[model samples]
Target: MHQDFPESRLQQLLPELIAFRRDLHAHPETAFQERRTAAKIAEWLGRLPGMTLRTGVAETGIVATLAADKPGPCLAFRTDMDALPMEDRCGQPHASTHPGVAHACGHDGHVACLLGAATLMAAEPERLAGPVRFLFQPAEEGGGGARVMIEQGALEDPRPVAIFGLHGWPSLPAGTVGLRSGPVMASTDNIDLTVHGRGAHAAYPNRGVDPIVAAAHIVTALQTVVSRHRDPLEPAVVTIGSFHAGTARNIIPDTAELHGTLRTLSEKQRRASRAAIRQVVEQTAAAFGARAELQLEEGYPVNVNDPGIKAYVERVAVEQLGRERVVDGIPVSMGGEDFAYYVQQVPGCFWRLGVAPADGSPGVESLHNACFDFNDEAIGTGVRVHCGVAWSWTRKGQLC
Candidate 1:
């Protein structure tokens, strides 16, 4: 028998949904490396009656779209398939099989929730009045997977007016959701600094221009890029993540390499920080008779939510989950996501699905953690959020 949309059915499907989550978690894959994961997703979606499955959209990515009997708007639900590089410490029965790869960011849960939604939508396609697209996106960890999928026209054909996505938050309790109207996430950029100097014997101090000293100066100066160069009111961050140089303690190395990450909320700040970072590296290296090269790679854009769409989704979330379960004015996450790339193309909103467990669990474990796992109880609420938003937006009454 088909499962009902009522709360009881969502509950009834828990065991199966939990199994899906574990299967994916046990065999986590990294960005652009989700081959088996994609195949399993294709198999799962194929069992649904009305789904038109498309695999290899952007190299190991899958897209299964469900069309309603009655024509209406198109709605998208995305689930990232890649896992982060981390050892498992959760000690769960389904610990990661891949050494150094773990579903620490709750991507396993994200995939399971999307599958759960597909199961419900297929069983009750009549309840769905519009076209629904299930985007099993790959490489969301850092590879700009959404941009690649969109470039291939994942949003084409029906061309959804709004795209919705959810992420697990361990901070908020299981039933509640984290939401916001504007600037929900920060933009990310990576800077690689290369300093060139003359190598010499440790005995000869005057003969060599030490790149390590120059790198040290550059790193220290970078700390002031946001504080000294940018406005205090605007939010920006420049962090030196790694510094590498010298093989031997006795001899000076010829080249020193330093890499850092830059994050900003505003475009102006993003641009300004990039320039300032380059300037600091070059100027510091020049003072020590060495030269510096800087390469700045453009990363995920900032996540800006459409106020109207955000309000509509928030309302549906409250109605289905309860008033207290829906929250607003949540602080923006410093992490970057490819969903920003999609919202950059169309009007959309990305929200938080709280998977936090009570019973005195530790505070939120940031994404990419080795021990982190997504909460399974979030499946029911997540399905309701997507289904309700799609139905509410399609109903004749309004454009919610």
Candidate 2:
């Protein structure tokens, strides 16, 4: 089906792409510490015929550029370089060699696909009518690396008119591409609360205030922030993930600590939820004769897809993988992506590339699971899609 020049060449490079992904899997690095990964990616990009490389961005990010003879708008393709801080349990031959670190999120495959696309594009530079920028960002897991990269000038010099990126999805079958318009992913915010109270013996609750009891009430009341305070139609989540208190069975600690995250699809909802959380925590703790402190950290913004850009990507997907392989109306996710930063600055579309196993296959796992492994077959799918999007925009001077 892929008879075009770059697609044909990209298909031939699947084995190499798989190898590159496995190597990244073996030596996974997390967040801003992708020094080795950055070096290797830079080395590979250096071999691309006309690409000029820039390194040491956002600590360990890389940016490469390629130009075509004809005139057109510059386009950018981005992929994350960091891995998760977790042990690999997949036990594959190329399983992570780094202890307590793994590419559980398929960032390894992302790099491979982008690399494969760059390789194909580099093989025939004349096909592109304008410049192309390859962005290898670090710390996408939670460090907001895209924001850092943008601050460090990833979008300057030859600013991109449009950009595109993808994440692997195990929910869809191997050959499908998932697309959606509007808020595709939620914004993430973190919460840290500490409740202070007088220490008391477990047997003599009347003598001193019990922070544990206050913490329990606080947690129970926090749930109401979503159930009663927020509108049912709006999507928001308030989860108290960690709670710590009490040193021994007989003694109630003077303070209880809580950690959690907030997710919302819109700024208005985010503000409302924050207000509700503070009110519930403080009031519930005060009712228990305790004082509470809450610290909220703002995280990545909600990932919104430009409608026109989303439609353009959909057309490109159909052209690359056929109408049967392209999907629409895929449900939105609560997960957060820092790619929101890039698209917030330029017109961009971020979509999903299916990596699910065929029927009856074992070892299929979701993102961030210790047993998760990037399906090699998805590498070619992603490469084809990336090449298709790039080709469509560069050659035709418009995506759709």
Candidate 3:
């Protein structure tokens, strides 16, 4: 017999969830290269009753639908499936076996949690008032998987009325959940630039235009785009993370390459910043007697949370997990999430689940860190939260 509530059943299935997370963590896959990961997910999810599986969407993504006994609008629970291109330093027995690829962003835990919720819902489909969709997305690490999935019709055939997603956070203690109202994350845009000039011996610098010098000046000048060009009150970041030039100390290279990222909170600001950056790069290079080329690779848009939906999720979280474990009005982040695309299509709420251990066992293994690993204990918390949100939403009908 199933437990009276979802939390008890999630706790009972904690061992299985932990095993699934560890397996996924050990066999890491990055971006659209999640074939093995997708297969494993499909295998586990296929066991549930009333589940209809769709594979190969967006190359290596999976969408599983579970029908309810009664008819109503569908809801979605989404999680990423891709790992990062980084080494695992956690040294756990289940640490990534695939060198240079690891689940540093806690995506393994996210997948396990969503699957656990699916299991609970499947155990007693009669409890569900409507159908639910499980989105096992791929390529979240700078690949725009959600946008690709949308383009490929991941949301069609049984489009959900609203969706929910969660990320694991190290800043908060385990069992706690964080929420915010609007603009939860920033937009991401990448910049590629090349400065062209004449090459000559360093000792005879006067004989040729120095692209290195032009690139240096350009980098320094781009700093002003965030400071003087954009409104200080609005959040924006311009960082030149990579620069390459000069083969030898004695030679002034003919071309220098620069790579960076631009992050902003709004579309208008994003466009304005791109224009300003292009203007600064070309003009700055010209001032140094060099030519410049700039390519702005557009990325995920700002992630905005619907207030009414967020409030409803906040209430569900508070009810499932005690008030002490729920944090409202959490600070907005500058990071980007492809889930922004899904919410852009439907009203959705993406929140944070705390996975930090109390003993500080693996001190500060933050997201994207090579040494990072998901806290297994938090798996149950995540599972319960997702299950609670799904059951509450399906039973109560549309909250807002």
RMSD of each: 2.5, 1.5, 2.1
Residue-by-residue lDDT tens digits, candidate 3, 1-400: 1134655666679898899899999999999999999999999889998998989989999988898334877888899999999899988999999999999999999999898889988897776668888999999999999999889887877778888999999998788999998899999999999999999989999999999999999999999999999988888999999999989989988999999999998888999999999999999999999999889999999999989889888888777778888999999999999999998999999999998985656564889998889988787778777777777775456532
Per-residue lDDT for 300 in model 1? 89
Give the winner by TM-score: 2
User: Per-residue lDDT of 346-366 in model 2, one digit per residue for the tens?
Assistant: 988999998897453755699
Over the stretch 269-384, how does candidate 1's per-residue lDDT look in tens digits?
Answer: 89998888888888889998999988999998998888988988888887777787789988888888889988887788899988877554764466666667777777777777
Residue-pair clash count for candidate 2 = 0
RMSD of 1: 2.5
Question: lDDT of each prediction vs. the true structure?
Answer: 0.84, 0.90, 0.89
Model number with the top lDDT? 2
